[model samples]
Target: MKKILIPIWLLGLAAGCQEAPVEASFAASETAVRFVGAGPAATRTVVEADGTEISVVWGSDDVIGIFGRGATAGNNYPYAAAPERNEPSQCTFASTDMDKIFKWNRGEQAFYAYYPYAEDADAEPNALPVVLPTQQMQNGPGSTEHLAGLGVMKAAPVTRVFSEEDPAPVGFTFRNLFAMVEIRLKMAPGTAVDVPVRRIRLLSEAAPLTIGAGTVDLTAPVADDPLDITDGKKEAVLVFGEQPVLNKTDYQSFWLMLAPGRHPEGTLALEVTAIDNSTCTTTLPAVAFKANCNYRQDAALSLDEFVPAEAFNATAAVTECRVGEPVVFALSGEAETVDFYSGEKFHQWEYADKDRLEYSDVFFSFRAQMQGGAQLHPLTVKVSTDFDGTFEEPNILTAAWTDVTTRFTLPTKPWTANNGPNTLERYLEEGRMISSGEVNLSAYYDEKSPYLYVAFFYHVDKYDATLKNSRPGIWFTDIMAVRAEGDTRIPILSQTKETVHIVNGDKYAEGEAGSDWQGTPYEYNGTTISPLRMWCVNNPPGDRDAYAVTNKLERKVSNFGPDKPESVKGGGNGDAPRLQLRVCGTGNLRNRTGGPEQDAHRRNGNGLPLYGDGKTLRS
Candidate 1:
């Protein structure tokens, strides 16, 4: 049968007067009464009425209290209190006073009732019972104190009036004042082992209720509400023995009777203490609970698996210059220069003769030969912000330069001729290479400056250095600064040939007996027949070579050996033929034989033998 559950707060009542003549009947609804317990069978009961035994399910313990009002009454009187079930389903009132009989239709009358009547056994005979405090109302039974166990206390009211002409069964609807809560433990999926549940408890802020006038003052402050009950003692906590397992299939379950209140804001905390385990305890936050409501909460606690973070692998594509085809730098003393001989060709500074060289502003690019594994290294490309057409005034290292490497997005392909322009593949087979794209320098370009000092360096960490030579070397090709406006290629560095004058056996030569190359000697040989005295240039004659013979040459053979020369023969007679060469104007002439300097000597300057003291051709 369906039974209506109700909630009520008992209060101090006025004295009840004698009941007038009234007739009434009561019957329960078809709704089954819900029992709050550890399980479903806690609410079973049997009711007897008029010598007939009826198996009726009471919501809680088998106890009932009824109060009635007559047709002309001053106050409601408690007329019947039945604490247990009779044999034949017949419930008889304790009071047999017939003066309070039912009268036909004088005024409306009703009955008020509550379950577990003995819970209020200390009440006065004709007066209402003293209302219990909210905390004391829903307390569990203590070992030393016999308090009410986990059960429901409801207040049912009947509003129907009875008469002989139209008899109506009075229906009562009960309302429980306390909320029912059931807690169960579970484990998360893939949890291989079970953890024992040592203890469980709720946590919340406390707000007590003051009992009066058939209602509760929910605004009262409590000294021992959920928030105040932190001792976790037997009176304040719901204790449980240590369970063997707390897993998905096997776990601990229990119920708790909490005081009725609106817990709308803060969460209802359930702290579960696991038995001697690595993960000792866990608290389930934000468990919601409402006043006078039934709650079934399942908490799942799982151990988080350990997973390591991923490592960073940085890669890049660099373009490199081929051997014998490097982007040569001009011999400008402004930039630091280092020369190493690799191939047959001498790779000297291109514009070493010029006093100053200017290069157009353009993009610079190269291939970076990264030797280390997949690791990100700092590659900085800085350009002089205020070059000011000079290399000395502002040192390139200390001068103001903006790093433009970050401005360009470099390609990340490994250096290979197949992926690069031109015949880079053949070069790769010979050596390692990195293909780098054009790094734009348009932002820092200045048209007025004679030359822009630029530098490229790699700041690699020493830990990531895995090459035989820890120091990495970068090669570059197509390394011209081109001005896009006019498609002009700046002359930063260019190869040039020059004829350098050399004297055989001269003190200024590489190995000589007496040479004043660094300083002028006080007394130098004006003329001599010593085989070393025969002047000769060291370079061989070729299509690219030119010689300017100002004074007529006297051909002679001179001994050339590490030991001293024995004698000198005239007109190409010794083992090595010797041609007497003369140094004319400006003995420090370039390597090229017939160039602008030779032309100038033939035009305006005197054709004097550079070796003699301006006296005779043979001198």
Candidate 2:
């Protein structure tokens, strides 16, 4: 994903070698050897020059190593061109001592020449030794001064008649023995604007160049064999004397000379270092270089964004939490972006491992009690995979619910003292508020859905409510669900009073149906009265009060108002509030009343029905 495409142009390295006009005649007194480039037929094209032709003229300090089959065979015949004459591609050369100029030998003479003269080379021109510099310095684009020591060029042998009849200088056309690469670097598309690039290094374990002294056989055909590099190098660093800001629209060219060969794929990596010392690297494609070829590699360097690892810090509030639990965390330091990891098997940091079919076991827990003569079981836990987020009764009734009530235990007898023995009172004295033990709810979990709706249906048939005993009110507390993973238990869905909400599920208006109230004994005695309900709070000391859904559900002695022994009110022990549910009417009290009538209960987190005013809940 971090890679970008770069176009490259490969062409032959062209150093215009042309023949000059022959002179009328040579003076007998002038015994100097004159030289000119080969004819136009051997000329190569230049890709980035002022014109279509590019010429390499001799420098003031330039010298060429020549070998003549006659007297110059045992010792090198160094030829120095005058500064004035060196301005042109064709020039006349003389020995270090002007008096000892090159002289014509007897018979048909044979001669050879090479430039960037190497002192370590043997006197024999057939096998000359040369070495290239590994460190290259560039002044600016199109500059070739650094190529003087790195570029190796050799001219073909020239055989001509040395008679007075011939006055024209013998010409030798030079051909580069190695390849040249013109790297035109520019900012990649979408890269940061104006990145001050300080340096770029080309690295390859394949040893792309032969930097050590090597022997080149001039006798053999140039293309017949490759250069014999005695010692090769794996990397080359190009240092820009002037630090330039990279531009996305234009490219800056830098040239390098390398021994020609096939560089394998993934063998070359370009490391670009910015002015701030940050660096990024990209691999180059495979390429085969040939002698005398100029590979103009246009690379769009990519440095999308750089962030140091030391600039980030994140701390979690707790080491572990249950599934669906609100895990708190504190983030510090800086970053361009951040992603959360749930620490689950499939939900890892890796992009590919984000989904799975397996899921952990879930459990539901709650405490319940029934008063009066509630003959029919009231609480039934049902699950729905698809539940639209709304309090509309039609929407809840239309949703498909799978009855999972058989999974948990339900109370079989009433707990009020008038109805039966005070079974709920005896349990409350022991601090065992959560009477119904945790029940496994894995059967309702659907991996395909993000949330599972669990609804507690508290309803009684109106036909069986003729006697006050038939309308027994049910109580529920500590209602919650959690995920079980080995020994660890993760909170799946839990809510407090602040998060619970109540909505109109029937024809009645919103606030009128689900309002909290204190029910009087007369209300419960009425045969046609609706179900009486109220909120109460009285949690025991040194308990998990925060985890309890409701503090208490049974009416205390303080709630009795000098009425029948069975009378109930909505006030807990003197200080805390209490709630009581009583049936007083003959109308149907079912959650779904067959037609459009439904219960008025709003849903909280994870699609669970709640019993508070319609408002956002705080878990």
Q: Judged by TM-score, which candidate is best?
A: 2
lDDT, each prediction: 0.32, 0.50
What TM-score does each of the candidates earn? 0.29, 0.43
User: Residue-wise lDDT of candidate 2 within 144-175, one digit each (tens)?
Assistant: 55665566777666655566766667666566
Clashes of 1: 45
For model 2, the superposed segments whose C-alpha errors exceed 4 Å read 13-32, 39-55, 71-74, 82-87, 98-100, 119-123, 224-226, 305-619
- Determine the backbone clash count of candidate 2: 12
- Write down the lDDT that model 2 would get: 0.50
